[model samples]
Target: MPQPTPDRDDQARLFREVVLVLGGVFAVQKTDDETIRRVAAGLERVYRRARQNQRSTTSSQALAPHPAIAGLLRITEAEGDEP
Candidate 1:
């Protein structure tokens, strides 16, 4: 089995690699203004939640953690542009 990578740079690299492998066109696509702003807001919330999660000891490592995964997480959770 492959070892799980935990280093920040390594995780980022892995994330990029995974996205590249899985996302295709949307792996690096851009969206319109309102959609971009909403995504940015959701990302900001995720960052705040990440900070809080660090303080609170959240361990699931998944962005949303819980099954609900929330609207905020839904921003990042979009698999691709196509429905």
Candidate 2:
């Protein structure tokens, strides 16, 4: 059986934890720009690979943003489009 989706509160908490962990990494004085760039590139690769896997295994609807995350995705996309 498929796993149940997390509730909105759990999703929000997870997002916040992700942000905090990433922020902490970047905040460290020893973290160099090159390291940050590599971290970002690795994350991009992971995201792309996961999306590809999902596409091969599930319908496009499975890739739709969970309702808890839809607004955040929209805001992030909007910010990403900004110069």
Best by lDDT: 2
Best by TM-score: 2
Candidate 1 residue-wise lDDT, 11-65, digit = tens = 4565457445534533356545676567556655655564344554565775545
Total clashing pairs in model 2: 0
Clashing pairs in model 2? none
Query: Candidate 1: which stretches are off by over 4 Å?
Result: 1-30, 54-83
Q: Which residue pairs in candidate 1 collide?
A: none
lDDT of each: 0.55, 0.67
Model 2 agreement with the true structure over 7-60: per-residue lDDT tens digits:
545655655686578769698766888988887776666555654444344445
What is the RMSD of candidate 1?
A: 11.1
How well does candidate 2 match the true structure in TM-score terms?
0.39
Error of 1 at 21 (Å): 13
